[model samples]
Target: MTLEQNPALAPVSDLPGPQAWRDIGVVCPFDMALDHELWRWMPDGVNLIFTRTPYYDQPVGLDMAEEISDHGEIQDAVRSVMAISPAVVAYACTSGSFVHGVQGARNLSKAMVSAGAPAAVTTSEGLLMALDALGVTRVAVATPYLAELTDRLTSFLEQGGKSVVSHEGLGLDRDIWKVPYATTCELIRQADRPDAEVIFVSCTNLPTYDLIARMEQELGKPVITANQVTAWGALRLMGREAVGPHQALLQATKG
Candidate 1:
């Protein structure tokens, strides 16, 4: 059945106008964590800036909350990047955004727009939206975050109606920029679950465009990561194609 037959598919008409190549500033933790997967998942010609954090890695254990506090000054720091002409700004922290929950992401987005950029923030909350939009209720999660960070992510997902049947975290202390691509892919593979309808790799810093398709094929489910969902959210807000991976979930959903 066409979208014409299903009212739920009404996105084509009400979709915002004039979708085009535009820059989206990322208010990120640790500047160097902004990897190539972001640009690769983007449709084309999207511009970005990675505002680095001094800690440069996922906070270990109890320091996670302190790390979130550390990023509190990000709005002002990222404003400098957003000031350059990017149409949207995403505060790309899965944990920090989740610590605020859905309402928090909305408030953060409102703050960005109010700041003269007319922006949107993609946090762990946005990932909830992405999963909901994809029609998933059961998810498998993989991340570079330690257990505490992953637990926060777990709380956000469970509260949002997505159930995690299988979850794993690398518990790494190294900066994401130094995370080898092979290890990233392996973590996804190890984390893949048989009963999951959706797979979420929760770190924008971890490169994943190349793994989404492969992992999905192996697990037979939709695969998404922090960067992919954030970029897709930003694109849709700006009226762009939420396109597919070579083995992409968005691509697979297209008619």
Candidate 2:
């Protein structure tokens, strides 16, 4: 029994070789609660490595968004994930990236690249790219933020040369992730307008993966969510496509 005679302990032949995982680093806000939603957009053989910015006790608001988006904090977070040498790093917070403005979003991506990420994408920038990919100019936006923050998103979109035909917000400063899909659907309904070519559901913490295709069918327009665009943009930078089956953004042919 001591001479390697245990049948249960014998190695099996034809074992698969080591997996070749394509890693994408994700830098999220401390309060981000939808890592699973991000994963839903990833294709097979891809892995998402997430690291969060330092926690801030402040409620989710302009100040909180600004604090969590600090360049130094984000750079540090990017460095924390650099050991894995991710193909691209994505800053996966919508409000944090857009709260400052278009240039602010670009700065965040630049900082991540400076911090050793070969490439970087911020959610706000991703939204712009999604709009471009879909060839849409007028958009309706739904958010779980206050009027002030929601207004900032409108301005960001305007700066990107997209018209914000209609927009709505829930005015909540925290617990955005806890929002139910029914409520979010109603918000989208309220935000949607006849002139809007597309509808954007902002806020990475807000859950919208299960609602994108449904909402698109109901609204008769493409629906792009924060997490969806973030993952799409990151994967596109790596010359890969995201895994949203019926989502228009994922299926769009970029020119």
Candidate 3:
């Protein structure tokens, strides 16, 4: 029988309700494995749900291209998350966000809103907002993508009005999550240029939560990662303060 025919499939509403709680949904890429990093930053009383867009493997360009082409799949995922009645829905793929450029990111968010989400944001769009909030225009970038895809990101950023002082990539075609924190750290160091006002580490699947604050401290500048900005944007959509010690973006949200 279909879920509609099964009474047991109904959403649980009889359970004890918290005094207050919020639900946030993440529409992720198919190969995503770093969702736990988003969860790690979630405040108490917020529930995080995930649904995947079509993607398989990577070098960024291929996987992200597939995701961008799967507009139907992405809309369906957003609608599915809406079924849970989340306060905001996030398209949580960085490459997918900027792949089509700024207008594309805006279009993606519009589609999510059309899908019934009360509000929505994509990672690339989020990055732009986060950068504005931080008052930064010059940035250094590190990525777990090939040179071509990295070039796409730099162009996207430049189009967004940010100056990319330096950019570097690991040139990996797959297994991006396997990249260690130490490697990412070194990439940031190597990507750093004297004039860069901030450092941006791209890719939602790359693990980065453990060291964002430490990186910022060591670099003496903001070290923004994909997951952190994604989470921060969703929180902003929720009309809630994103409070997390040591995370510069989150800390910046405090009044």
lDDT of 3 by residue, 195-237 (tens): 9999999998899998888888998888998888899899888
Tens-digit per-residue lDDT, 120-160, candidate 2: 99999999999998999999999999998999899999999
For every model shown, the clashing-pair count is: 4, 0, 0
- lDDT tens readout by residue for model 1, 1-255: 896787676776786655555787877665435656667657666666655444535444436534643433666655677657788777776665776555665666666666556767665656876777888899888888778777877777887877888889899745665677789878877877778888798877677777778777876778888887887777766677555546565674444
Ranking by lDDT: 2, 3, 1
Number of the top lDDT candidate = 2
The C-alpha TM-scores of every prediction are: 0.79, 0.94, 0.90
**Ranking under TM-score, best-scoring first?**
2, 3, 1
| C-alpha RMSD (angstroms) for model 2 | 3.6
lDDT of residue 228 for candidate 2: 93
Q: Which ten residues in a row have the lowest lDDT in candidate 1?
A: 53-62
1 or 3, greater by TM-score: 3
lDDT of 1: 0.70
Clash pairs detected, candidate 1: 30-53, 31-52, 244-251, 245-248
- lDDT against true structure, model 3: 0.86
What is the lDDT for 202 in model 1? 82
- Best candidate (score: TM-score): 2
